[model samples]
Target: MSRLVIAVFWLLHWLPLAVLAPLGQAFGLLLYVLVAPRRKVVLTNLRLCFPELSEGERRTLARRNFAITGRSMLERGLAWWAGPARLRAMVRIEGLERLNALKAAGRPVILLAPHFVGLDMAGTRLSMEGDFVSVYARQKDRVFDRWLYHGRSRFNDQLLLSRHDGVRATVKAMKAGRPFYYLPDLDYGRKESIFVPFFGVPAATITGLPRLARLAGAAVVPCVTRILPGGAGYVLELGGPWADYPSDDVEADTRRMNAWLEEVIRTMPEQYYWVHRRFKTRPEGEPRIY
Candidate 1:
């Protein structure tokens, strides 16, 4: 199946360049709905995170999340061809000075961006505008992986690392003055994870954040990319370096960081990727809904 996905991408990659972006976007959204395994994961995550929501509310949020997920798949591809100058037009960026403050202080800025609306563009643009940064990611499939590499690094310097090398790569990048971007909210696996309070519930979170910051002296900055309804484009809001967070008690700080992330995500709950299996690896044998 993965090989077929690769073959399809290669076939399309050969098509006229003009059709790729939109075609990819359509493919992403359609796959989000039809992709059974990830679809179930997303649905479970949504139910666990937002139990207070009515069935109607859950359905609405799910629909919106899948749409954004699909669009993110496509928009990121367009970002490559869009170019920095043109992308700046598409995304009206603000709060750069805030990020620069950390750079000026000789502290690398570690952006704590949870998956929101326009993160693909947000991450891409930041590297273009600033000193360029590294971000944590699981290696993607070959066809898409090669495509994303060109697309993401088009105008920016993206030092992407695999999950295993996450700690070492981030530490080195920040120590050398490169700003780092990581998603602290998504659920990918159980290794190196510590359950932390998220949205008033304990969620398995990456424990490397505070330790990395303490080791490398990088400041954690929260960022969110929100695409407006009716296609008004996207807005990226940046939140600040949490002053004087402890080197120890990482679990506590991770919880606090995730709590802030949850708040940001909740403001636009419908846009959040709720279909993810955020609570997939719960501590107990059975998963609890919220």
Candidate 2:
């Protein structure tokens, strides 16, 4: 069934990306809404993250988030197959100049991009803005992993490092004065995290960004590309050149950075990619909400 789905995904993927962008997202949104188990995960995340919101608001957020996820998948298809230039028509982004400025500062700027919108294409565009390398994640199937790795790395010679080689590759590249982009969210089914205030709630988050930045004597920058309505492109918001990240207090830096990222996510709540169980990993005795 999974193989069949993947095969169908590949077959249908080529059509929308090549022809119609909005039509493509509509398909993805419908498909995900009808079939993905991740829907419940998104709803749970929304309710937990925004307790103060009324029930109707929570539902609205969930629907919006799902649409964003669909839009991201659609945009990625366009990015990989047809190229994401059309995606630029979807939303207006801010803070791009900040990235250019960071790159010129002589120190490699660590870009902390949240999973909101056209992150794939944004990474490529951001790379052109500066000397930046992004860590590529391993997808489920090895064949798919290789395929995705090549697609994302095609624009620039991004070192498609494996998870095991991530830190080594990043540190080496940073030493060479090249900036590295890494997603500091996601729970890898382990307790290797700190309870950080994300959306005013303690979301278990990876402290890798602050740790990596501190190691390279680099500055930490938060970037989020929001998915807008009507298949509008995206707005990539860049914030900060935070110094002394991941100080002696590991949890503090993690919390601070995560809070900043959460604010960025809040800017466009629906496109924030809430389907992933972000709080899957928790320390013993730490309250798990989702």
Candidate 3:
């Protein structure tokens, strides 16, 4: 079944974006109806994060998010198999000068990327530019895992460390001039994570951003990818390096990271990955939210 899915993706890669984009959205609509568990997760996340919004508004956002998520999934084919020129033409990168300046000054960088739908699109586009280091959680299925690994590393010199590789390997890669593409928003349980307020709710966010930055003496730069409306493609934006980050307080720095991410998500709520159970790990004595 996994091989058949890969075959379908390969065949679909030949279609133009105008045709593929709508199909991806339709696929998402189907999932929204059929995938009850994930659909419930998305709605639950929306309720927690956007309490001010009406139930109808939250449902609308959830549906749009599913559509974008579906598009991002199907578009992996372009990242995996498309020509370099074609991929380059599809993604427009902004604020790359900021990244270049930091590297030019011999400063290691941590590209703080959140879990946006266009994440892989941005990563694949950036990989074309040069080598970078990022972490990946191994999928349970071997066939799907192999396909995902190849799709991500098929481009430039991408050094993908497994979750078990730890901080030492990541810092080593940073010291070697490969910027770390770090995603620190997900719930990785209680260990190595602190309960930080995300949209006024305590979310178990990993403290890796500040720790890794301090360890590697790297500058933290925000890297965000936005999917444009219609079949227009994507834009990967790089924010200026954060000043005075990784302060003496690790928890405070983690809070600051979550605060910044909340603001960014507000800009494009639909593009954020809401299907994941972000509040899965509650504090002691707290009931399971998922």
* Steric clashes per prediction: 2, 8, 0
How accurate locally is residue 128 in candidate 2, as Cα lDDT from 0 to 100?
A: 42
lDDT of 3 by residue, 74-97 (tens): 888888798889898899999999
Which is superior by TM-score, 2 or 3? 3
Model 1 spans > 4 angstroms off: 1-39, 136-140, 287-290
Q: Tell me the tens digit of each residue's lDDT in model 2 across 1-290.
A: 54564465466555633344565556656855696577678777888888889888887677656555665664554444444454344334577667668666767777787776568767655544445677776888876665567556656556555667857778888777677777878776554667767776666677787678777877777777755455345566787677666688888888887777677666667777677888777667876655
For candidate 1, give the lDDT.
0.68
Question: What TM-score does model 3 achieve against the real structure?
Answer: 0.98
| Best-performing candidate as measured by lDDT | 3
Top-TM-score candidate index: 3
Kindly list the per-residue Cα lDDT of model 1 for residues 1-290, writing each as its tens digit.
65575555445534433454445456656876687777666666776677898877876666667766666655554455565565675566667788887788787767877877578777777767755555544446766666567655666456767666757776887877787777767765577788777766667788767877787777887778887553455677777777886457887777777877777777887677665667766776755543
What is the Cα-based lDDT of residue 48 in candidate 2?
80
What lDDT score is found at residue 29 in candidate 3?
A: 83
Q: Local distance difference test, per candidate?
A: 0.68, 0.67, 0.92
